[model samples]
Target: MELTCFKAYDIRGELGTELNTDIAYRIGRAFATFLKPKKVVVGWDVRETSPELKDAFAQGVLDFGADVIDLGLCGTEEVYFGTKFLNADGGCMVTASHNPINYNGMKMVRDEAKPISRDTGLADIRKMAETETYSEKAATPGTLTQLDNRAAYVEHLMGYIEFETLKPMKIVVNAGNGAAGPSLDAIEAALKEKGAPIEFIKINHEPDGTFPNGIPNPLLHEQQPVTGKAVKEYGADLGVAWDGDFDRCFLWDEDANFIEGYYIVGLLAEAFLVKQPGAKIVYDPRLTWNTQEIVEANGGEAIQSVSGHAFIKEKMRAEDAVYGGEMSAHHYFKDFAYADSGMIPWLLVVDLLSRKQTTLKTLVEQRMAMYPSPGEINSKVADADEAMARVYDAYKGDAIAEDRVDGLSLEFADWRFNLRKSNTEPVIRLNVETRGDKDLMDEKTQDLLALIRQ
Candidate 1:
């Protein structure tokens, strides 16, 4: 019963300690027994331990007589896509994502790429993995094969854009020495093969698990300047960077300004609405004014969901939403099995630019001006519960409205803020936004931080 790596949504733990090859083999056996999947697709990121761990998991699956399709070093979403694309029974991605290099994890999916979170059988899997009471291996061990899913995966991504009409655009892609490099290269090569009007300026484009440059997380304030500088240096039309697994991508405008993922939600909502009016667009509760405005203005329904990929995907399926986005840079598409993709968003943005004959700056400048946001800011605290309560008490009186959809969100006449505790870490994330008032956004953010720290 010693299981330290299992989590609410996926499996994550430090290498050689909480997770090792033996545990991985047991997890694979547990998954095969639990899901009884006829075919399982497995992939791993570019972490040092990933290959050995992935092989162990594959062996476990084979022991249970489930066929295994080994997807070599790739992004997490590729596992999601491959599950459905190949009509496999289930899939797993060995990746720590943007976590520190010492850490590693797994993301699993069921038939049709439906996620397998703790609530949806991960808990039982965890127990089986802990107890090692898996059913006896099949009389005939399952078959194993290797697959190159990149070409098909690239084609699937390019399907989202109309290439013939695309205008020439210079894009800077910083892979941050993660698994994103190969996929981007494939897509760029395919685009060139078709003679599409696009230019790629790649930086830190190699996939090195050592992370020679740094971890590929663009969300960090310190990491923002890297892509910004690359954009300015290349004079690129836009800049994009992916996390360790490339499941999430961060962006920068032509002016080297880092655009908050919240605004990208609005920008994308607007783009999808133009094509499929009246479609439902799902967004998180962290920051809502801009998303709500854009969705409503574009004649689409704006549905709010709790954050995290599992929650958003669940909501997207339930509502049949066309698109769902979290301000944290995870974007889900209906056509994409309601799974998030770091690649799809940038492609969609490029299409929007070509269709509108304008810059990313223009597309988002108005929305940003209409409702300025300070973005999500995280603060470490001794007790997150106490901090949340104190902030609620201080602002509840002046608030015109409030909701606890995902967290404590207080709305005033001119500005609103949401304070939510991190599910994975002991920190409270605060986001402040106002109606065209940068000063108000600035003042309220600092004020809330002071109160939280107090």
Candidate 2:
């Protein structure tokens, strides 16, 4: 067993190599033993190898005399929904998220959609796998029941937005041939039923295990071109895309301009606060100023957290936060069991546009101009710590203030920069932003890159 597969948030590795039935069985057994829950729910994506892995994993769970509910061919978010809907003790999702076709992994959640992080049980699972603690088989195998909730999931999301209050808008939706197509199909009809003025131009709506259109990761620059082209080709008001498992979502405004997830965080915070004033809004530490301003302006409390869904969800539950957003495109909601929902954010935002009678660009343009961002820049360096240390040393004393919440964050009077090492990759992610000072942000970004290169 490769202990490295146990990541900060979930277990992931190359499919046939580091991840296989043997590994899956161990993980299942570990999960069942550790959770010791009465019933465990299981879900998987459309990946070709997901079925076999799911079966093997469930078998491990049953060996421990824990019943398993198999939620077939669903997105990871659905697994979250199932955990809460069925009142299960815990759940595991068989997915590698946006990883390449040759990779797969598992994401586990505690009862009521709580996350299982390294601090919780991920490390124990790794240790159990390594130690080969095979428990004695029970007298009877736990039963497995196939279940479907995609329709109910869609219906639940619809309850958040008012279709009769929406205006007809042209929007381009790029599923990237992931698992979002079915959900989007349901949403479109639901919107039409309420007489919404909305038209969807969809691309790569078909789910294909081969990922012929490319991996469903919308973060990569190469993947943006497809959605960007669609936005321009159709002359649409906006474009929305999702990752492989549809856990995170991305947006593009009119004229094919990519909207920063940070800005959307503030926008959604403000929108959600209008209905739930005094509610706490959760945001990652990487992008703080804008989210703080938005929440404070709306009379809502702002809670800063480290990046990743597990950390955000845990904080959201603790703070009883009404909403949470990460610069990485993950958004969480209180209504959805405090779990992140890739579907609801877009739906609510679109509904906001309709209720306000504005375009998506119009809704976000002012905020974008107020806080120009350098966008997240990924640098592949020999040593991430060395690169981050060099960058930090250069700016530490010079900056007005510094923070080590998630990584190294330096705040100047009018600008700021965050340099953090990736949890899963040998790289450093650098994000710089300025208070309406694009030239200064650009110049400082280059200077930091030069320092890292040195």
Candidate 3:
């Protein structure tokens, strides 16, 4: 009973063959058996199979004598929030999060919302699930209860910004028919109650598991234009789009330009520094120049961490950092139990706009020019390890500095690039950046691609 659904960070699998109610129940029982949690929080997304899966998982927990608090339909962050807010022993979210419509999965976290990765607890859970050995059922099974923590979650988001300072603005929000619709509605309702003059023009606002408008992943180049076009048509001050689970968010500017997450990391570093100078900010090593410069100039310390939510969260807690961001649109905050949130990033950006009295383009354009990057490019390879080795061998001669913190990162005087194998797929990911030289960035990007693909 090897579980193909278990991945590095979470659980994901194709329906029927790899994952069904039985496997889900086994995982639930295993999770309870390993942690021996007294109480657990559970939630699901918009996928049609998610409700049944959640029910099955909850029953397994109940049979193991662990109480279940079911949050009907919500994003992944809500479970992270509920775990800490309710003081539950653990939490689980049933969602595939940007995977195809035929897929579904789950994410689990322990007390205080600590992530459960393969290194931490997932491997043990998988082994226990496979063995099918558990303690006898409790004499009286644990109770089941329903809870709606949206209002409290929305209030927690509001605490990140000062609503009184918010100015009149129009924004475009595209939920892409995922679980984000309901959560965004709660935020909008809170904003309206506060008499904020922000206007939200919604698109694909319903939660449809069919994904009528394609997957909600705005990270794809093709998936970006829809949000950008809406920004221009609505004359919006900013544009935002979210994936199925709404853990990562993508942004668009006033000119309908898709702003890369690298620049947003720099912008956010500066924003947080303004409020709390000398704060520690954790960033990924893939893109360093922009975030490094901004953090240093703002009287703050910049620390580098390997890319991934679990690694970043662990580092933030270790250093007690103020904020952490990755180039993949995942942003973590110290106050949110070191969990990433899609809603909080945009709200903080809006606050920055109001406080700085500037547009989104004005804030990030200079930084983009200062450190030009083409964003991350992925190429499918027959062997990801061999491709990375080939790229490194070709460039190691002229490289002044080399790092393997997460993957291969080689730096030269004028430009640098990081090439790493994808943890979830058979692809090589490349990120190249130059010092204020777009042509060099372009030329090097092509050269690297040629070698990587050859």
Candidate 4:
């Protein structure tokens, strides 16, 4: 079968048909053959097919004479940690992330936990996976070892905050029945051991591969209510939820108002720059003004990078940025190998709440009002490029500045917008923002939608 799993950044596809144990094995051997590492770390999410696929991949690694460190069931960041913390040669995590039940995939990394995406090394791996023929050759059979990195991973996460400074507050954690429950429980225990008076209200805390609560995707407006309702009913100070692999986190305020990821980018940047003045903060181009304003106000430099984890991580390292965030909820830390961690974002936010002695709303509300954004809106069109081209044609002359950094972005005196094609789907995404004018944002957003949908 042809390798239809590889994408620009990672591998994802429908299970059984496009992805299976056999294909996974070939991918494993191909990864080994391509990277040729002495030892590799392997981890999987709490999915039904994850174990079998993980085993097959490990076998392929061993088949190519590479030792395997089996991390068993874990969030994606654990593999990243284990790869770096263990000083391993490479790593892989078998997780489809927030995809539906029928789909599954893998994320790979090389030495020092650098990502292996399409342009970097994934294309070569995909090509080799399709063309390589395995034979019983005389080579050392590699050994496999099981490791539980919970204590180490928790320690790493807690390193982002001082536990004693945290105030006594009730917070709700919605694990969504994915792989985040155990990690949260461990962190809670660590905080208690440190004598921090933080109380956790855990819901959907069990890890069931069946995803009985549905996928842990908080991007859907429907998924927000479950955690929001629980937070309000429990009288908690804040609510946090994660996707299946737990790589992305979404937050709700004490009043159970769901905060858009765009605002959180600014929130986290401010939190980081306050602690480290004159530091560099990296942000995606999709939603810019809020993040830029906050970063500069706090004596820091704001650098804009393209969207997606790989590009963000690269820019973070290059700029030595203290923190990076995407509007899609992926937050990257310079301390965390510039890699995005869903777990660390909330930890940092909680630290801010403790240090500032303020509510999340108090910190975010003014920023939200000062730079109103309508969030991202997507529309299907016959040709994404054609739609984007038409948008540029209509707005180019009037735009104060036009950039095609990642896609088409145009800025005017009162309003600005970015129109880009979705990396994984055939749709055009439009984002509109105004200079603290909600009505203008709404009007320009509707006007642009009318043009794009035509």
Clashing pairs in 1: none
Any idea what lDDT model 2 has?
A: 0.87
lDDT of 4 at 378: 95
Best by lDDT: 3
- TM-scores for all candidates: the values are 0.98, 0.97, 0.99, 0.98
For 171-201, candidate 2 gives per-residue lDDT tens digits of 8998888888887888898777767778999
- Candidates ranked by lDDT: 3, 1, 4, 2
Identify the runs in model 3 with alpha carbons over 4 angstroms from their true place: none
Across residues 125-221, which tens digit of lDDT does each residue of candidate 1 receive?
9899999989898999999999998898888898889876799999999999899998988999999998888999988998898988777788888
Provide the overall lDDT of each model, using Cα atoms, as 2-decimal numbers: 0.92, 0.87, 0.93, 0.90
Q: lDDT score of model 1? A: 0.92
Best by TM-score: 3
For model 4, what is the alpha-carbon lDDT of residue 269? 91
Candidate 1 vs candidate 2: the TM-score winner is: 1
Q: Count the backbone clashes (under 3 Å) in each candidate.
A: 0, 2, 0, 0
Candidate 3: worst-modelled 10 consecutive residues by lDDT: 129-138
Model 1: worst 10 consecutive residues (lDDT sum): 212-221
Residue clash pairs of candidate 2: 168-197, 169-197
- Which candidate, 3 or 4, would have the higher TM-score against the true structure? 3
As for TM-score, the candidate ahead, 2 or 4, is 4
